[model samples]
Target: MCVNAGKDKESAQPPGCPVSRPVPAKPAQRPERVSLLSYLLRFRRDILSAQPARLYRAWMAEFRTPFFTSFLCNDPDLVNLVLTERPGDFPKSGRLFEALQPLLGHSIFITNGKEWERQRRIIDPAFESGRIREVFPAMWDAAVAAVGRLEPLADGRPIDIEPQTSHVALDVIFRALFSIPVEDRTASAVFDAFRAHQASRPMINTGSLLPLPRWVPRWRARKTKATARIIRGLIRQLVDERQADLDAGRAPDDLATRIMTTADPQDGSTFSPEEMADQVGIFLLAGHETSAAALAWALYLMALFPDWQARVAQEAEAVIDPGRIYFSTASKLKLARAVFRETMRLYPPVPMYLREAARAERFRARDVPRGAQIIVSPWHLHRHERIWRDPDGFDPTRWDTPEGRESSRRAYIPFSAGARVCPGSAFAMTEGQLILAMILRHYRVALAPGHTPVPVAQLTVRGRDGIRLTLTPRKTETP
Candidate 1:
């Protein structure tokens, strides 16, 4: 289904400027073509390689697709051109967006065009740095609560950090987004329904990759419907409560209120209750899931590299003043931040991004026919051989300097990028650093005997079997 890059008759030629001269014939050029068989061979080659970065580079040297295709590129400039420079011409893929639609509905993350813009306007204000500052207390509270829960586990005992991080992040998201703890039975049910729905849906990497119909998967359809019911009921209750508060001329200055009050500048329209629920659903999923992935990965990395963990602990100890209890101190731990950045580089929460060409266009000198689905993987880019010096290595020190940050940005995209970038990136990073620093301050983690974290692609890049580690009391205990 490739479309040619030519104008239609209505826009063909203005009266007669170039009618006299025939267009010059150009020699046909092969655009790095790789047949389906060769493509899968390259895919397997890269997947099996010890150095995946080099393999990705080799894969990029050719094009491959049998049915519906995806162009996997590792070039930095080319990527920037696609994601940042001309994003309008390359919208998020319809297939991918539709797959997420069951869970996210028409939320900002899944929708494009004017609808996406409107949703973004309503929700973006709540994720501002100032808002994140307001929510720091909530995040610290969750981290402290998590640490308290883990204190009972003795040294040498295996601990699954994924559930712990998940719980902490879910608490943070609930408090930050709604100013209410997720302890209510109604709220718990909503989140439970969502998790069930996620599990029921088959593993579809991106929308375009799957050919299965929604009805063919009866369980998925049921879960989708159940998810909508749970979320809608929760949203209706919350909205009514907030509206009642507003009626009484008093409302908490929480995320809910902020979104309720935010109006589009151009049209000055507010989100309806249903629309607000959709936005809430998105933030709830995005906020918790992303932070959980980052925090868990950060801990896994720390466990694997004890020297760096110790260094981070020292940095955290030095920065945090006794009885201050401010999460803002997390920002001062430069090395800790570097470690978090490195972890994100290794296992970006949003590992892949998909876009569909708006119209036939040329990328670099290669022709990209319209309607082709383009796939870009942060998992591949962060480790792209040409982009990083030693791509596979866990080197936090690589992010210690200005040059390092620049280079990392060229390859690192845990939050994706451009207009569609994650709106809560600052909040996520701050929360991750604080949680990570707090964990380091409280415990010394080691790889549980016979255990190694194996990351796999899922709703996020998660440890397939769960990240198990041993917790030992830190040597430098505060008096």
Candidate 2:
């Protein structure tokens, strides 16, 4: 999975016994109980460390605040009910809307009911299996570009991989969506603006939990609004040009054109430039940011477990051709896919999901009021003590085990589940596998000595200081 998740605690180890297992790093858990003020302060700092360790074993944990109640559901059945069976009974939370609203606006990420459905109807087609195959060439080029950029940094010097993966992931999205690389000026500007925006946010914003008038300003509103405007403005410019291309019948067959031209079946209407810009903003965040975080952690995990890294590298050396790109190559990356899956198991990019109860309902035999926050934390669920075997151990091969497969079916939700699942799930998986394979094929990553990344989640799970590693060029026969 991820960091060394206290597996030794399960059985008594003779004092001073080496933990033999090479587990990735896990954040230290907070005490079981704390004052509301103390909890608030901790949450403001980092959502992961603000939690109790018992959450790993807990089926459902309730958080009662002065303003609202939050239920963090660790039970897989409960999670399925909330997300899969009865999603309509739990719409997106107000707190979630308040936190991401500035950047997302009415994007499918935050919309509800008919609006969400209509948006999905238009956006979903662009990411279909066939469309993903169409975009694979762009993805391949992005991976090649990323590996080339890292050539200078692959001198065995320590490097923070967060920004490295961020750049590449953003590059991948831009290339796929707009048929332009990240080096393009407008694409670069949007990337920079988005980077600034996410760095300032937590996964959730509890600061605005208090009952305040809409007129009252929340903290960091000015900064968030400013960056959102900058990014959205750049996106609008791109949309205008693409719309012109569409009007002139010279548009590239990319994701942008696909979505902007797809008419709603019910009403023959395509997204206007304004509407397309909003969707682009969502893709920038959900597709680019989350993929970056996961890829960084995946590399960090590779550094921690050299044996697994070597296996992936071996697979890459065998399956990948350094010459012309081929879409068929993605399916052969089984070990790399496993590595990515295990990495997300330990460090899900989007750690916590927040939804609001539509009506009063009983949960775990407890009375849950309507409007209460329903928290489905992939971070906790994936590593639940009762679900996965050696939950915290970094064994990429575990996916082949009975326990792993069963646990995965019951617990895994890195891209979430049901109706609101990430629309680009397939695209992200292919992107991760290709980039990871290409990078490992060219370079070897080792955890930089004296640097231990502490996992934290505000928006997406990432290292506190950053995931640092040393990359050395692989002296292999391949490219």
Question: TM-scores, in order shown?
Answer: 0.82, 0.95
Per residue, candidate 2 scores C-alpha lDDT tens digits across 1-479 of: 22333443424555555555566899999999899999998998899999999999999999998887889999999999999999999998877777777777788898899988899899998988888889999899998889899999999999999989999999999999999999999999988898788776777677667656667877765776798789888989999999999999999998999899899998878887877888998898888889999999999988887778899999999999888788999999999999999988999999988899999989999989988899999999988999998888787778898978989999999998999999899999999988999999999999898999999985688899989999999986544
Which candidate leads in TM-score?
2
Candidate 1 segments whose C-alpha is farther than 4 A from its true place: 1-55, 58-67, 202-236, 401-403, 475-479
Q: 1-479 in candidate 1: lDDT tens per residue?
A: 23332322323455543322111111122224545565444432222121232434642532334446556666777678778888888888877765676566677877888888888877788888777778888887777777777778846699888878877787788777667665666666666765665454433433234444655542335665676577667766877788678668798887888888889987999988777777777787778777888888888888766668899989877886645676568669788788888888877877778788889866657777787777677877887766676666778888766767777778677888788889899988888888888888888887777766666555666675788988877765542
lDDT, residue 374, model 1:
74
Please identify model 2 stretches exceeding 4 Å from their true place: 1-19, 213-215, 477-479
Per-model CA lDDT versus the true structure = 0.71, 0.88
